[model samples]
Target: MEIIARRIATEFPKTNQAVGVNIVSLVNALAGQVRIGLLIFLGVVTIVLLIACTNVANLMLARYAARQKEMALRTALGAGRLRLMQQLLAESTLVALAGGAIGLLLASWGTQVLVALLAKNFQIPRIENTHADGWVLGFTLALSLATGIIFGVVPALAAASPDLNQSLREASRTAIAGPGGWRLRNTLVVAETALALVLLAGAGLLLKGLLVMRTTAPGFGTENVLTVDFSLPRRLATLPGTPSMNTAIVMTDRVRFFDALLDRARSVPGVRSAALVADLPLGGGQDSLGFQILGRQPPPPR
Candidate 1:
């Protein structure tokens, strides 16, 4: 960034505004003022992933415990520790991969809806349809594999312990979880619960904000009120005497045209209370200003 800034300064020495490059993600451009909400989504996703990993690990532990007898029998039959570990890890990885496949389908549908919402809210014109491309698929696969390895490592190692006497004794009856296993399970459960609560709170806050935005009045009645858009051509904005577009007479001609339009609208059958509006509530509007503040100087755009 420093090098770029220095180069920019050297190249555009005479520029009045700051000469620099703006570095930002596509999300910033699409989200605009609500860009921070992307961070909220990120936080929620991270927590959700953490919860999933914890749940997977806990379930794997229970599954491995239930299979202690079979594992002991295999050990007694001269099964190698590495082979047992590999087997357990493979099963966990497959489960994770299956879940990832389902998640990918959901993500594809979600991406479409997400893009539509962004386009509508941001008023982006002619946006391309969203789809899960090869990159997204690859990322999901990598994430699933990594998650499986991370979540399955401890349980796989515990189940692969060489000592079979304890497992064999416990296999005769119900298996009891060791202290370390209990601690890991309990800690994961607690952390998952905490993160879930945080996500819930954030969701509630966002929901409340949306409700507030929806309920707020837009300073206009929409019921039975229709807006018609039509452009006033140069001829329409020119008076009968004017030959060309004159700034001084344009306003007069425009007002005359609007009055004629309103009259025509009111003359239509069943039409009442005709009005013209330059801007509508909760819709796009444009305003141009040429002025300077009395005591404050506005900062230049960078």
Candidate 2:
């Protein structure tokens, strides 16, 4: 009928407008959530990197102390300070490069597991979009180089100093008792401890926040609720005005199928009411839009 067709045209446009608004809202929400998740991930990675740097620094310091005799002999044979420094720097650079290569492989595998865990625990939709792309690789490479320089420079300078004779003698007597060496080592240890404390505190705060949110007021009871997901095949997703002759038949069949399903579910023992919903409480994939009350007086400004 002409009337039915006209009514459908109007209703279909409104329905499509609503769906578009919902999709845009969903996308924006998902983007925000993913951004926050990435930030948290970067923070964790940075903390791990700092710990690795501290460990590498400690290892290099120990090696520097043990190689004091070699350094002393080189200096005694008239090796220039600049040459010694270059050699130490080169050695440190080589070690750093090797570590960086190993770290890249580790990070590649770790990133996959990290993404999988995030998807599973947080219900992040379209998680396959997350990957260790070129940017991630570049960032990891830069981080590796920076870490190497930070942890290597101090030990290299100490090892390549012109006054190696006193350091060698002290190394032979007792390395730990050296005046500035103990101070430097203690300072590194304190820094590592502080970083660890900060990371732990952040984790504790996140857990406490989750606990508070979970315990806060949830309006509805969910004791006997059941949920289901409905999806349409791509081939069946023709828009209402499309030139698909079978669209009406397909839509009618789909509606009837859902009606039958609900009827069967309701007929089952212990079933109360059966209703369909676009989203469920605590479901992660849903989003909401903001609205302002109209014709209401504004509150006093603070």
Candidate 3:
């Protein structure tokens, strides 16, 4: 491809030194910044998930601390350490699954709201078709189970091996937790706070960027403007004195068709004007066509 580009550039001898070709993946060319933005949002979502998990872990720790006497009593009554851990993990898994169900429901409703909101502002492809399908359900289920086990492990381990004598001797329900338990809880709270701050900072930056974009003008009047997109048929039927393979004739027909379409649009009631363009302003994507400068000889035909 580079060699071909160099050969093509040589045809424009005066501009050969200035001309260069860059190869970009089609996905990158089409999705561009939108893809980057989605990735950033995904990272933010992951951070938020971590914050939520940290908070839940702290709560689980507190719950286990409160139940230290029960755990010790169970252990004294022939309950193995594995049994106690399993019980705690079961409770955590149940909580996580419940939360996941609720989140899934909210996400379903929220997706509709988001699609409607973004449709008016941005031109994201196939956004309207967004839905929680089988893959989404599978992912949610996996995430719920993983989150339950991962976040539950620390508190479960801390609670499963309680001091049998001290916990049983302490008659008060408000007995202080062990240093290990306190340390773990404090660590979780600190982590939760830090993650929250990071999320806030990221959100603030994104909001500021969005506000700046909204305020910035795109060198065109946008009010009262409407855009319609259409495509011409790729294959035309062969007719008398007309070659279906002629590219120039096909483009001419397409141009005339657009002109007529615009004329009809202008004639409609309450219509002030209409015009045609290859791409709309602030459309987030563009199509490029080949053209030569005036007074320059055209390149040889392939």
Question: How does candidate 3 fare on TM-score?
Answer: 0.74
Sliding window of 10 residues with minimal summed lDDT for model 3: 235-244
Query: Model 2, poorest ten-residue lDDT window?
Result: 14-23
Over 1-302, each residue of candidate 1 has an lDDT whose tens digit, in order, gives: 76778787777765623656677777666656464655667788888999889888988887887887788879899998899999999999999999999999999998899888877666553455557999989999999999998899888987777347787766543353777667767877898898889889888998999999889887767678877877788566455556566766677777888899899999988887899877766564666445878899976644
Name the runs in model 1 displaced over 4 angstroms.
1-31, 113-127, 172-176, 211-302
Stronger candidate by TM-score (1 vs 2): 2
Instruction: Report the Cα RMSD per candidate.
Output: 8.0, 8.3, 5.4
lDDT of 2 at 154: 79
lDDT of each: 0.79, 0.73, 0.84
RMSD value for candidate 3: 5.4
lDDT of 3 by residue, 1-302 (tens): 77877897787666574567789988887678689989998999999999999999988888787888999899999999999899999999999999999999999889889999988677777778888888888899999999999999998999898888889999655333667767887899899999999999988988899999999998989888777776655453333256436767766776687788889999999889888776666564457568998999999654
Best-fitting candidate, scored by TM-score:
3
lDDT against true structure, model 1: 0.79
Itemize residue pairs with steric clashes in candidate 2.
none
